[model samples]
Target: MAHGDITHIDIPVSDMARATAFYSGLFGWNIAEMPGFEGYPMWQAPNNISGGGLAPRDDGFEQPRSYVEVDSIDDTIVAAEAAGGSVARAKAPITETSAWAVIVDPDGNHIGLFEGVVGG
Candidate 1:
């Protein structure tokens, strides 16, 4: 992941099974639910590009958003705030090696920030 690279994406779906079937069928994606993240199934595209999560359509997360990889989640959130963006979600650990955060741009579009696996 690079500083400005679009590293991941997340799509909200009303029906997990239905949405999973549709996307996997249409794009030949391989989606599976991880043990800890049971309800939020992650997907990988055929070309091996990693992006997105099929999240339930609740809690004002009914839209699709892309994540940009950053070297520092805290620094990026600060910069986003300085640039008139607001934090949607604070930086949180996804795993021992990774973390992510969400922010809303000046125009009100949601953007996700990902700090990829650290010190792996």
Candidate 2:
């Protein structure tokens, strides 16, 4: 499995409009509302690669989290645990091809692990 770069991050917001405005002003980001996301809007930053999505949160969606792509979800989980982290969501497929899982690091910060659909 070959690890990919961090493609995007998702920021959960209580109010999408307010969050979007704040980020835009704070970072000078050109945030735009995207299709296929319903009411959620995404920001396209200058750097391009580290851009993030902003979505309205509902019940059961607690904590704003970030995702990091890895070569293998299992390997990443093992390393995180060895370094004092714990898995929040065991490695599982989000779709038939793509998989993702969540973990809490030593400091109790949430992170995500993703395995792409097409590649090994």
Clashes of 2: 0
Best-performing candidate as measured by lDDT: 1
Candidate 1 global CA lDDT score? 0.88
Score residue 116 of candidate 2 by CA lDDT: 78
TM-score of each: 0.90, 0.68
lDDT of each: 0.88, 0.77
**Weakest ten-residue segment in model 1 by summed lDDT:** 111-120
Residues 1-120 of candidate 1: C-alpha lDDT, one tens digit per residue: 678999878999999999999999998989998777889999999888775689888786878989888999999999889999999989999888899999999999989888977435
**Model 1: per-residue Cα lDDT at residue 63:** 85
lDDT of 1 at 102: 92
* Best model per TM-score: 1
Off by over 4 Å in 2: 1-4, 33-35, 57-64, 92-97, 117-120
lDDT of 2 by residue, 1-116 (tens): 23656656778889877898899999877788755456768787877656767867866347767777787899888999999999988888855677888889999887877787
